[model samples]
Target: MTETHAWKAEDFAQVNAPHVKTALTALQLTGDALEQGGAFAEIGCGTGEVARFVAERGFEVWASDASQSMVEATGKLCDGLPVTAEVCPAEQLEFPEGRFGVIHSSWVLHWVTEIDEPLRRMARGLRPGGYIVLQWTGAHPRSEGPGMFGILRDIAGSPKWKDLLAEAQPGSYEYPAEEVAKVLEEAGLELVHYEPDLPHPFSAKKTMADLPEMRERYKLAGFATQAAALGDRGDEFVDEVLTAMIRAGKTDPHHARIVARRPAA
Candidate 1:
């Protein structure tokens, strides 16, 4: 079974909405892509924000997530729209061959136990010349000085948190842009575009005034992973990490976007 993340669906939706919107805009999916679709699927439709966005554009959407709460939340969010919410994981997605004209995933692929099989399934599920857009953490920034997650990760790896790290689930998988494109091509999709860095509106600039806002955002932005690694002391750990980041003026993490197409029949 896929392990449930330590996040509530509502909390995730509230925290990730802006980032999701930014990703959709970066892919330029707000216009014609929605209008021309046969069917659209969001692989990890947390709270269904992106699904609803596509459905609002008049596209039929199948939104799936491993978490039942998330699926239910998606269903509630997408009510009255042409959308179906299912509790499905990336590895076990059950779509008929060539069922989708467009498939979209945001920050979800790295959770798969094995990447290739899911990519293959997605490739087969796309209709001829269909598009698949994905956004994921390509690489985390690690510099000589302390930064955001890097500091958190270092703290987690320390002897004080050794027991917690041993019990925590593995961290998300990240790959370079070239490797990502190669994987897509090997899965039988033509790589249309691959961007290693996709910009977001969030400012990395740290100010004493923004600390509270940053703390809240961190809680929602996969900091749960680090929190899990710190066990009951997670909050305290994050507080220190954020303080360190602010002191060092660390920026937000970078994300990658890939757009690929299945070959025409």
Candidate 2:
């Protein structure tokens, strides 16, 4: 879980335009619950694409991200739209009583260490009868290969570069289904809708919205150390990685999506 993401305001919007579809799906699932759901708060707003969409639909939106750059980018993108962007961590953000009706955190929780607490906090923050939609991705099975990390792991473990990448795990994280359910139950949230293991393939061809920007992504994707270790061959290493990704059309990513509501007290 090292620094694996490098996002700029200009590039993030385009590179992540694909995420807007998932954002729409979340909103579509929320439906009328959003009307009664009070203020809409989005954690991990990224470049605020989702926040902007939610605001365009007329809900008051407050967006937060761990990166100040991201918060600023969100603030800028969502400007003139009923949105407030801030810098905060999901676990640390206060979900005061009766404040938010729709609490949404998209594609963000897996980056966190303790997935349970954030769910608890989002649940606790919700108004009674308010709905919470939490979508966390990344449960990459180590066995699954040519998956993004698998390719990187193989390259790092290859005889040529093993020493430089002894401890490299580009994108290694797991979010088990049972743990997610336990957190929901613990928080007293009523089960509304749950979709698990939606595969998000990492096809370099499709994912690379801007080839030039994405070329820098290996660094952003937590290959900074290895890239640096490659020294004079760093550019060559980037080419090699990109070639591998292109050859492996799909990274076979696993995602967990959930929509639940706090029972009216």
Per-residue lDDT of 1-265 in model 1, one digit per residue for the tens?
A: 5445655686777787676776577447433566775699889888888888888887899888877778888899889999999887788886679989898888786566667777777888888878888877534433333334455666566777656667664455555556667778987888777677766666446676777777777666567656755657777766776787777676555567788988888
Q: Give the distance in Å from residue 111's predicted Cα in candidate 2 to where it truly belongs.
A: 1.3
Total backbone collisions, model 1: 0
C-alpha lDDT of all candidate models, in order:
0.72, 0.68
Residues 1-39, candidate 2, lDDT per residue (tens digit)? 223344445545545655667766876786687555248
lDDT at residue 88 of model 2 (Cα atoms)? 78
The Cα error of candidate 1 at residue 225, in Å, is 5.2
Candidate that scores best on TM-score? 1
Pairs in clash, predicted candidate 2 = 4-220, 37-101, 202-251
- Compared with the true structure, the alpha-carbon lDDT of candidate 2 equals 0.68
Give me the displacement of residue 19 in model 1, in angstroms.
Answer: 1.8
Off by over 4 Å in 1: 1-3, 27-31, 140-152, 164-167, 203-211, 225-232, 243-251
